[model samples]
Target: MNGAANIDQGLGVSIDLRATPKPGSFYRGKRHAGLIDVDQKGAFPVSQYWEPIYHDDTNEIILDPDEFYILASREAVTIPASHAAEMVPFNPLVGEFRCIMRAFSTRLWHE
Candidate 1:
């Protein structure tokens, strides 16, 4: 979910790591994640809500400054039989690192 309040706050703060602020790390599973390139072809993953693989001459996804990408995490998630959970981001205020899991309109999150 795009944080409504976060968008309104960090209008032009000039994000950087020089602040040495509290660090927030992500749990990239064994499969990690891949990027979808704008030049990707073939079928669009509308139903699956999956992004395409980004590739360049180096065959690596180039990360742009202050840009977001739709990634697929292969992390193993095991929920307790009687437990319920929600996907919450660490801290958008940091802007050093933040994550958002957005699925297709059919659902909020996907496998």
Candidate 2:
């Protein structure tokens, strides 16, 4: 299936993928904080570390190899409570790509 396809299995329903990228959703990481203080707990705004991505006149986002960007997928995914989702590093049909998942040490969440 493509990026926007819905998979149907027995009594399970797959996630629905959208086509348009959300506006003002791209953020780039300023720098990697090697270690986070688990003892300290407070408001950890995403803006503190990530800044809004600047697009060119053509509205194209050029990625920097040295920086990490939190890109919003054009697809919207909703996983069922009884099921789980996994990221595929690469899809042959889509060519070369990499997917990395990280768990942040913070109470505040943003989607």
Candidate 3:
């Protein structure tokens, strides 16, 4: 289920991870992707491994600028077999950022 109270004109709902008090994680260092075997899991280590992220007393996760993070939605979404869903990485009105979904992780860069 979407966490947003209402859906927008674009027929998209917002999923807020920060709304819930849950510890997140991030990865630092340069990003890269070399030759990988489809049969192997984590064939080559990309950047640093997943590091735990802690929230402050107010339950706010402080992220460093220009760093890469992989965060999940608070809600688990399910689409019909005939239907599909596309993830819009960023919204300028919300903030300037970028998200790239790779074979390893869904990287989110906060500007």
Q: Which candidate ranks first by lDDT, i.e. highest? A: 2
Give the per-residue lDDT digits (tens) of candidate 2, residues 1-111.
Answer: 457445553223221123334443566776864444544455455666668765545656666656776665444555557975655444565444343332332344332
Candidate 2 regions off by >4 Å?
1-24, 32-42, 91-111
Candidate 2 weakest ten by summed lDDT: 9-18
Candidate 1: regions farther than 4 A off: 1-53, 56-59, 78-95, 102-111
**Model 1 lDDT, residue 96, Cα:** 42
My TM-score estimates for the predictions, one after another, are 0.28, 0.53, 0.46
Clashing pairs in 2: none
lDDT for each candidate structure: 0.36, 0.51, 0.47
Sort by TM-score, best first: what order?
2, 3, 1
When 2 and 3 are scored with TM-score, the better candidate is 2
Tens digits of per-residue lDDT for model 3, 22-111: 444334444453344545554444434455554555756655665666655554445557964566656665455554334235332111
* Each model's total of backbone clashes: 1, 0, 0
Candidate 3 regions with alpha-carbon error over 4 angstroms = 1-39, 42-48, 80-82, 89-94, 97-111
